[model samples]
Target: MEVYSKKQQIISAINALRHKNQTLGLVPTMGALHRGHLQLVKKALENNNMVVVSIFVNPTQFDNKEDLEKYPRTLEKDVALLKTVNKTNILVYAPTVDDMYDGLTVSQKFDFDGLEFEMEGKFRNGHFDGVGTIVKRFFEIIKPNNAYFGEKDFQQLAIIKKLVEKHNIPVNIVGCKIHREVNGLAMSSRNTRLKPEHKAEAPFIYKTLKTAKQHFGIKSANKVTEWVEKRFAKNDLLQLEYFIIADAKTLKPIKRKSNKKTYRAFIAVYADDIRLIDNIALN
Candidate 1:
């Protein structure tokens, strides 16, 4: 378990392995290192000869300045947690913001077809652009044969797949199953910021989504949307920001899901000021 911060350092290490014909995998993260993140690393290690887990809290991705400031930066704790995975081939890339951005922290706009205008894109302005820029940078720097992400951000996963196709990047983008708490809350770095009571109530987000999945075929998409909206509205602890049943590929909200098209339920919730997003396949 070695650590490198600069892009050149990791690139140098990866290049050495490339000469030996070793396959490489990457798990890019903002580094509050939870079990969810480790799952990505484990999957990467199983498939590739080497793995790089990046720990930069990218500034370009946050539309709200304070959310960026308040975002967790537990580098020491993060490294310690990564060590618990107990793999020698694993390496950590904990770059400084300056190291990653070279001083300027701006996101390049990307066209994710119409996929960018729904859910997360609709709410967090310039968010996916930041995601695209950093992800593309990592793919360029490490040049991994495979990259792993969790499906918790279902829409973001779709955008990244589109990104690879749009750019002709060679790396395979792998979406892992969502890791969750025993209580059913989708694991997120932001979960660390939840208030005590709110933390207890957070599992309801997944619970509600599960119920909504149960209702999809019986109810129309609009009615299911209504059901989810009402479920959250009745909850006193958490606020529903948006919930949509959309075609999985294009991400357009659907009136009625066709057997021909795969669909999923996407939700965003606000517990006081902290925000969380989750999705589940409805078919």
Candidate 2:
């Protein structure tokens, strides 16, 4: 796979493809590639003539400096993985922080129609602004016909849809299914940092979600949430942060169910020092 770290070179290359009427796809990611990331690549390759996977750990998105500092960066291994997926027609854009924001700053406001102030937005201050900044930059730089993302970051996927519409960006935003481990943990780069024992226990996150789903129609929202809390309380290593059932579209908390609308249960937990998030559909 060809790699470009500069914006102009990549843009020039992509424009050459555009001249040929070649359809381009983009899979934007932070380094530390895994099965989850490759799944995105696989989907992109199936649909587009050319795919560009951009791997740069965006610093501005982190609410905590320490979290950003500890975030994984394994570029060599990441590239190797991408090559294994497809060495032809795939361009890896591994750019420097300066490559994206050389002299200008990117901190802008977005209106998600009240979608921004939901679970993730409420917890991580200024986090989505950073997400918006980097994603907008990549959208402008790559100018792909389609951009793919995993629904593992469900709220982020929702926010990105808003970002595209609010700007009238001429690209289709595609949300692929959440990739998971055999034991059911939603695959994440942070999963690599889990303590060995914590890794063994990490699948419990998905297990709890499944349990929550099973209890959905059988129990009230408050009772189902309390059940999730009690279930996690049984595990000393798993610390529950917050659990709520919210409208799938608006992401606003739903106190009760409606036959006309869909709801989902979103949860955040800490396995020792590592934080993980997951959500499940609830009828």
TM-score per prediction, in order, is: 0.98, 0.97
Model 1: residues with Cα > 4 Å off, grouped in runs: none
lDDT of 1 at 97: 80
| Inter-residue clash pairs, candidate 2 | none
On a 0 to 100 scale, what is the lDDT of residue 212 in model 2? 89
* Deviation in Å, model 2, residue 233 alpha carbon: 2.1
Candidate 2, which ten residues in sequence have the lowest lDDT sum?
103-112
Model 2 C-alpha lDDT per residue in residues 1-283, reported as the tens digit of each score = 7789999989988988998999999999998999999999999999999999999988878888888899999988999999888998899999999889996655667777878788988888888888999999999999999999998888999999999998999999999998999999999999999999999998988998998899887888889889989998899889998998999998999967889999999999998878899988877
Tens-place lDDT per residue, model 1, 105-160, is 88888998888898898899999999999999988888989999999988888899
The TM-score of candidate 1 is 0.98
Judged by whole-model lDDT over C-alpha atoms, candidate 1 comes out at 0.90
lDDT per model vs. reference: 0.90, 0.90
